[model samples]
Target: MDTYKNVVRILDEVLSLEGRSASFSRDTALLGAIAELDSMAVVSLITALEEQLGISIGDDEIDGDTFATVGALVDFVDAKLKD
Candidate 1:
């Protein structure tokens, strides 16, 4: 789950949560559920994940569900890496 940890780090930094993301779990709420996960944050997160994981995120691939939870996000990143 290295990608998961990397994403969590990105989220933590993007949201300025002071490492609060360390406490997040698979079921943790994201996207619109998190105050800091606005449109700009989404763009930043996508860019960070793409750069860090060396994967391209398609424009059509962007969706709220992709950022719904830690597990979902991990799954997305894993899928991208596999491609």
Candidate 2:
């Protein structure tokens, strides 16, 4: 499975982006840059990602840096899947 694409799809669904997230590149900023990505959204996103991808994410594993960019988020998800 393609982790990057799956991550993007989940982001779009969780954030209610309506396909806007489809254009996000690796460099595209997320947390602070996106208006829809508030703290609650982050939690919802984490839940959605965990449920959809079959990965478990501990609270300590998350931080602003994890959602800094599209690529960073994908990398975080990839790493979580490995464990």
Candidate 3:
């Protein structure tokens, strides 16, 4: 799967979004809206993303924007992979 698709799947599984992530777009707001995206879920998503993509996410790299939307998160992952 491509980066966006992988990101959608990860969001679905991590957030228990019931596959709602498929319709998510770059402008779709996440973060505070998603009920399952608490602190624990955030950490879980970071770990899962790192393991799946073989990248490292530093603690200081996290922020509201990273979890702001599916697109933002995917872009962040893409940027990390490009490094």
Candidate 4:
């Protein structure tokens, strides 16, 4: 499966973006740049990613940088999957 595509789908669902997330590229900014990606949405996105990707994310493994962009989030998930 395409990790980036999956991540985008999860983001769309969790953030209720109504498919708007489909247009996001690797450079697409998230977090502060995106009004929908507040604290609550971050938690929801994490939960959705964990459940959908069947990966466990430790509390300490995440930081602001992880959600800084679409590429960053996908890289974070890919790294977690490698472990």
Candidate 5:
């Protein structure tokens, strides 16, 4: 998933946030902080990450904490890549 960069790209594209995510560091908050990151956007983001990164995300493996911050999401993808 290319970790931070790709995750930010996916976030920017999926949320239609222009380039706002470009400045996001690992500590940048997601979920409630971004108005565009609703339930539907989260689903689309997950799909995009799966397709673009060629990683499989099982239904049972997701939770709100996974979307807590940029670092959290990147860590999730990193773990998936390692598997």
Candidate 6:
């Protein structure tokens, strides 16, 4: 699966970024960079990731690093899918 693309899509939908996320690359910062990605949006993003990606994410599996960049989020989901 293209985890990176899926992560960007879910992020755009969850954060209501319209199509802006289409330009996001793996190095694109997320956690403290995007103003739309507040705490509530993070929760929504997590829920959306779980629902859309068909993966259950334990709360303990997430942290600041997971949201640090688009690459990190995709890696997390990829890792979860592998597990």
Top lDDT model: 2
Worst 10 residues of 1 by lDDT: 1-10
Residue-level lDDT of model 3, residues 10-32, one tens digit each, is: 88988888989878897788899
The residue-by-residue lDDT of candidate 4 on 1-83, one tens digit each, is: 78999999999888889989978999999989999999999988999999999999989999999999999999999998888
- Index of the highest-TM-score prediction: 2
RMSD of 4: 0.7
Compared with the true structure, model 1 gives a TM-score of 0.92
Model 4, runs deviating above 4 Å = none
For residues 1-83, what per-residue lDDT tens digits would candidate 2 score against the true structure?
89999999999999999999879999999989999999999999999999999999999988999999999999999998888
How does residue 33 of candidate 1 score in lDDT?
79
Using lDDT as the measure, name the better of candidate 2 and candidate 5. Answer: 2
Error of model 2, residue 62, in angstroms: 0.9
Q: Any residue pairs clashing in model 5, and if so which?
A: none
Better candidate by TM-score, 1 or 6? 6
Single out the weakest 10-residue window by summed lDDT for candidate 4: 14-23
**Judged by lDDT against the true structure, how good is candidate 1?**
0.88
Please state the error at residue 25 of candidate 1 in Å: 0.2
Q: At residue 18, what lDDT does model 2 achieve?
A: 99
lDDT tens string, model 6, 36-72? Answer: 9999999999999999989999988899999999998
Each prediction's Cα lDDT score? 0.88, 0.95, 0.88, 0.93, 0.93, 0.93
Q: How far is candidate 2 from the true structure (C-alpha RMSD, Å)?
A: 0.5
Itemize residue pairs with steric clashes in candidate 3.
Answer: none
* TM-score of candidate 3 on Cα atoms, chains taken together: 0.92
lDDT of 6 at 12: 93
Ranking by TM-score: 2, 6, 4, 5, 1, 3
